[model samples]
Target chain A: MRTSKTTRATKAFEKALATRPTGRCVLRLYVAGATDRSRQALLRVRKLCETELNGEYELEVIDVYQQPILARNGQIIATPTLVREYPRPMRRFIGNLSRTAGLIVGLDLETKGKGAV
Target chain B: MKNNGPQSATPTARLPKCPTGIRGLDEITSGGLPRGRPTLVCGGAGCGKTLFAVEFLVRGAVQFGEPGVFMSFEETDAELKSNVASLGFDLAGLVRRNKIVLDHVHIERSEIQETGEYDLEGLFVRLNHAIDSIGARRVVLDTLEALFAGLPNEAILRAELRRLFRWLKDKGVTAVITAERGREQLTRHGLEEYVSDCVIVLDHRVNDQIATRHLRVVKYRGALHGTNEFPFLIGEEGLSVLPITSLGLNHKVSNARISTGIPRLDAMLGGRGFFRGSSILLTGTPGTGKTSVAAYFAQAAARRGDRVLFFSFEESPNQIIRNMRSIGLRLEPLVQRGCLRFHAARPTLCGLEMHLATMFREIAAFQPAVVIVDPITSLLAAGADFETKGMVTRLIDFLKGGQVTSLFTSLTQSGHALQQSEIAMSSLMDSWLLLQDFDGNGERNRVLYVLKARGMAHSNQVREFLISNRGIDLVDAYIGPSGVLTGASRVAQAAREKAETLTSQQEAARRKRELERKRATLEQQIAGMRSEYKTEEAELRRTDEQVGTRTRVLTAERTELARLRQADAIRAASRTPGKPKPKSKR
Candidate 1:
């Protein structure tokens, strides 16, 4: 069932890439340092943007160790946090970006919500 | 409370402390929270946990010259600043001076979602940046437990917190982590498990409908701390932990003396008055002139140019002044001159601790040399017996510490137990004067006596306490066959003695007159006898001269008769008979 879901998601992702939504999704991922967890979160968030945001989203990664002032301005508490900046109501997803499905739902990128992908 | 073994056995093994610069708190923690280690301060809602944390940071920055970082998870920077501004902490000014850094960690439960695994590295980074930006040596995570509600996955949160405390310790910055109190643990999230260097608990308890805030040091590692709970107040200055037991008997004493306004009373008190800075307990029954006596002392102190602070529990200041006026004590002038101040309040207006805190504040502000609490027993209605006693102890200790003479007037029930109510507080007093109302002589009378004077020679005699228009007077109560006489009885006794003395004086005058008359009559009788003796002497002289003249005439007549007889021998014999007759006449 998981394999079938992934294939279907891939086809929709292609369609989204071709259509290229007008409102570019702005994303920022805040992490502590160049750790394994931060790397995994970075890779996962990038993949999510490419898949769900149709390669039209702007993604930026912030290492809190280097730019701590930015982290404080962003009110980041937990490391490996993904912030949806362009969204009207800014949302924050804490923890390493290992649960892609929840992140997709949380970021409101469920393919226009055909019953939550 | 836990004692962490032999770590505090030696001075070298003890943990270096960071002085909090909080009143009574440093004395409780011996110095302060352990240096370079996180101290967990947990308390229930509205127990002053956040205030305590903020004060710690502010004091560190302002007083200790060590900059601090305040990372509040509950209140924003503006909110926290405004909240502590009431306590006179200029947080904004401190922040502008780079002595403090405020980081309000906004955490909302609805805004944050946990996916899988995470750590609080962002928080750690922000804290580090804020600290390094200001060179902060102190850090505060005020109510950090808000993170638990804002984020999911408690397991990760716990592990991250443990790491965060370790990081803070390793950073060599003293940190205070405030948390919500738990039902079964020290904190709601058991944060005590992470920050174990020291744990302080703040409590807001309402006992007998009186709410009081208490602070306790539950555990201290490698340091000795006062383990008992202490009453603390979030006053205008800041959070002050009133460690009542922290006051020792080592306060310097003054050998100076002050009067009680009433000269006779002063004479009774070792012919001087109460010792300077001495705590005096003036206990009496209702209408026994306790307040009057206290007013006298206050007036005396004010007259001597010593500032007097009067605490009236049973009457208003104006009322006290007016009542004292009836006894010729004019407090208005002293008040106008700024030598006397009156703080009047109802005992039931607040809790005992609040009352104590207010008294302390007044004492500190006024800096009075003499303090008078009129009818202190009314405070018994505010708390339990032991609590009242403790409050009095703290008050007296605070006063004596400043070398301020204090007078406490207590009202007692009119019975044999009049001397028993204030026994608990009498031990803390340097002198105790007992005033009683005697019901005799068809009227009630006030009598005062010194019950105890620790280091002075005080009169043990009771005196009649008379409150005339001239003021309070301590006259010798007539102690005679009947009993201690006062009021009208004393007057009547005095009058009777005066009458007796008059009668004796009149009798002495009458005896002196009688003796003088008898002496005059005897002298007259002796003069009359002398006159009679003089008359008899004159008559004797006349008779003797007449007899001599008759003898001479008889001798001449005998010569004529001898010549006429012309007889020879017989005439000689007749002349011899006539000569014998003349001899007989001689």
Candidate 2:
């Protein structure tokens, strides 16, 4: 399930105190309509999440059409809006979920600049 | 005095209300389509019927933060979402947040069996559910005509639409109902005849082979709205209606003057310049240097660190800059410095109202000290004559209220020699410059003249000008015997005069030489006469000498012999002979 930014951030802080895990993250994709573009984005994001954050992450997909209340809750304006809910300091990206490198950087997944992944 | 006796009773004063968010649409309606009442949006096919209703909902939600609901009779939720995506409105997001609800009411005309009695209660229930679920303050019905296709009974369909509009009012939601325009009636099935609060008609017409979309507010009870048809635009930015009406006489005015950047031209306009916030019309035929003059004004304003918004209807920013370069107007640097903004678009792309709204939005965003519309006449082609005039007047009034200096260029027919006749906005303009091409001596010359300037003295004389690589330059007008020679005629006349003067000087020198020769001949003859007289005297002297010599020779021998013999005899008797001869003579 997609959690609010503040709640997810608070949970991350609590987890940091409870257990010093090596790496963990939570990602959510907020899309307006389920067009071919949004479908492609969902598929690509799912694959990336499974491969990258295999055991220590949660991925949730929210379609604004089916769930418009969530869109306003997120203050989303454009379609395929992705919000990085976890890891203290929330961030969001608007557009198709392409550009893996940019997404990784945006999510703070890589530890170092070049070889962290 | 008697009217003040019953002052004790006072009615509750009604507070001024905000419009139902359509941008400039609110200002035209004075406040907006009466609050919480049904305002019908009717148009023909593909004339933005659905989009207009949707935009009213979207703008209300996003701009005003008011919750809205959209009831579509034709399209599904998915179709509406994607269609509005290009306009940057995420309708689905509004839906997800419960701020907006999109009800896709499916109606199959072939399947529905119309009994003796038919009502829109099903649609009303769905509408009420959507509106209450979101607490929507605004609602839109895509097209009421769609129900006619299903229900054959015209009387029932019309009655049902009337009931639906009344229901919306009772629910206290400001609703916009879209309907198809009919060929025989203002609305399909004469729906406009039944609607009470307000009726707006959307039209898409082709005139002179150009397609133009227009919106007219037919009736708005208890509210004042522009009664003229307004041109509208639908694009990535959504639907913008241009309300062509003045904002009335409450605008602020300033006496400050701003330069148009052409020094001589500015000098012509009251030695200072035009009023700071006034609207100036630069009208002329093609190639009369309208764009150059506007660019020069924009660049000048930018140089003073004041922001300038330049709207070009004909040329792109690059083309305008490149062309201005010929006249020494460098706008790229100013644009780079963020002092100047260049917006270029085709006038036919949007309706007059949309263009004006876009202009107002840009002005609000940029907050420029000056705004320039390269050619305002291009917009006139999009509407009827009266409509065009109203739109321009309203635009000028709005600009004046905001204290933004507006410059507009208009293209007139060549050789007409008349002021801008398409729209009667000349009197409304604070300053007017007339540019024309005068055909004289078989050559066309571009000339600029100030027609009128209110509250300022301007040059009335027409000045000759040239559009060269360096920019526009005011050349002194050539006054010839026939009339004024401008452009090529003046240049040719100057050359011809030089040639004539040289030939005349040569001819006069030839005459002088002939006179000098005749005088010399007369002088020589007089000198010859003196010589001849001397010769005659010399001959006379020589003849006299010869005569004297002959006489002396002839008389010398006889006279000497007689005198010698007489002297010898008379010598002795001379003493005695003198006394005897004297006595004898006595």
**Predicted model with the maximum TM-score:** 1
Q: Which candidate is the best by DockQ?
A: 1
The local lDDT score (0 to 100) that residue B270 gets in candidate 2 is: 76
- Can you give the DockQ of every candidate in the order shown? 0.62, 0.01
Off by over 4 Å in 2: A1-117, B1-18, B109-125, B151-166, B190-194, B244-249, B346-364, B377-387, B412-414, B419-423, B436-447, B466-586
Alpha-carbon DockQ of candidate 1: 0.62
* TM-score evaluated only on chain B, model 1: 0.89
Model 1, position B265, has a per-residue lDDT of 84
| Per-residue lDDT of candidate 2, residues B461-504 (tens digit) | 88897878777777777886778789888887888988899899
Candidate 1: residue A63 Cα off by (Å): 1.3
**How close is every model to the real structure, measured as TM-score?**
0.88, 0.61
Write down the TM-score of model 2's second chain: 0.71
Find the candidate with the highest lDDT and give its number.
Answer: 1
- Candidate 1 residue runs with Cα over 4 Å from true position: A1-22, A112-117, B1-14, B416-421, B517-586
